[model samples]
Target: MAETKTPTPMFPVVQGGGSLIVAWQIKGKKVVVVGGGEVAAGRILNVLNADALVTVVCPALGLNPEVAYRVAQGQVTHVPRNFEPSDLDGADMVLVAVDDPAASSIIWNLCKERHIPANIADVPPECDFYFGSVHRDGPLQIMVSTNGKGPRLASTIRKFIAKQLPKDAGRAIESIGRLRIKLRQMAPDVEDGPKRMKWMIDVSDAYSWDDIGGLTDDDMDNLLKYYLSGDVPSLNVLKGLPDGKDASDIDLFDGSFGFSVGA
Candidate 1:
């Protein structure tokens, strides 16, 4: 007797109303784009953003002029040569576009044999995963992946979600980056990573409401002194350090670097 087949789930169809999420490191790695049209554009365009070395292989090609210009400018390398299954050798990632099921299958198999991750456009299962729309805000980049269900809708949602973030987010990330250096220098004697990390987190979290201008260099200096002194120091010793915020909250005794030069 023959067994009955069950219908596959329509998760991408149902839930892909707007967005999805994933994280990866693709910079300076080797990636191959196999195809010519807009399908290939979707892959090559983004790979360049990460500084990944990319090669687009297509025997017959139709590229938007800007992409062609970038190729000529050496921003991206393009190969007008035909793609063979073996062309995928030594790739960190492969994106297949030819729109030919047989060709896609051949390349997918080769990628599998070589232990490389690949994405097959317009065909989800054949791919490791499909591309999702991206909404970027400084260190806060949000991507919506629908398992490749509805890319148009995903991008649409990304546009709206992007508006929900503040333009100052990038500036804030930059500010945090600046603060970290000052933090490490200010508290040179604090030997614990957890403590240091906690300090960073607390300062950032505190930014949710308080005007962060309260965190000045002088305060940082006092806080470090209080933490490292290990003995009771006066309350006035640290200038910018937030009171009762962490282990550095209380004054220690007999500290060389107390709240004041007098202390």
Candidate 2:
């Protein structure tokens, strides 16, 4: 009989880098999570919130009754079993939250082999990616990450950071995003980062536009064109646009940019 040697644990692996991030609609799609612990429940909750059809596969779950009730209620599907390689088939997304490293490693290998993206809890060595600790208020979601270095520390800081966010922060970020797009279309030549940031600040802070109240959508179009093209005919131009009239119209309160994600 031949003796087997243990392989090396590949720690501190770089999972993802410098990639463009955006939210996607996942309603009625398949998302599989493996585990019965609080961590697994958390991942499932997030997936459910995103409107994805979620499936949980675990032999035993130490979760709340509500979650199990959801399974029984047919809102979410639960499979009472340990994982197998065949579980990877047709799985849009996979989450491995099991405590067994060997089982997690197998699931990760299956996902890799099948070209499915997988997130493994506390098992970065076998993870394709990770979900950040999230802080969401209405339209604002702040995500913080440490690139998988110190997850607990990163999450703790994010919690503290979230405590400091104002109620209208999400709306403000959305407003800025819309304004930036308008500027790009209206003033393609002068559309740079600094100018866009300046325009956002000006519109959100020192100046306010309140003339687009009764204006047609076409008028709003022209308004954005003018601002981005350096044709600031009037400070009142914003009023002639849509959804541009209120303290809640913009969410520039939070200084967080590119810091809204996973640790």
Q: Which candidate achieves the best lDDT against the true structure? A: 1
RMSD of each: 9.8, 14.2
Model 2, position 121, has a per-residue lDDT of 88
**Which residue pairs clash within candidate 1?**
19-144, 20-144, 20-145, 219-240, 231-252, 231-253, 232-252, 232-253, 233-252, 237-259
Name the lDDT value of residue 132 in candidate 2.
Answer: 75
Global Cα lDDT for candidate 2 = 0.68
What is the TM-score (0 to 1) of candidate 1?
Answer: 0.69
Cα-based lDDT at residue 78, candidate 2? 80
**How many collisions between residues are there in candidate 1?**
10
After superposing candidate 2, which stretches have Cα over 4 Å from the reference?
1-28, 60-63, 174-263
- The TM-scores of all predictions, comma-separated, are 0.69, 0.60
Where is the poorest 10-residue window by lDDT in model 1? 231-240
The sequence of per-residue lDDT tens digits that candidate 1 reaches over residues 198-232 is: 76666566453223334454554544453343432
- Displacement of the residue 159 alpha carbon in candidate 1, Å: 2.3
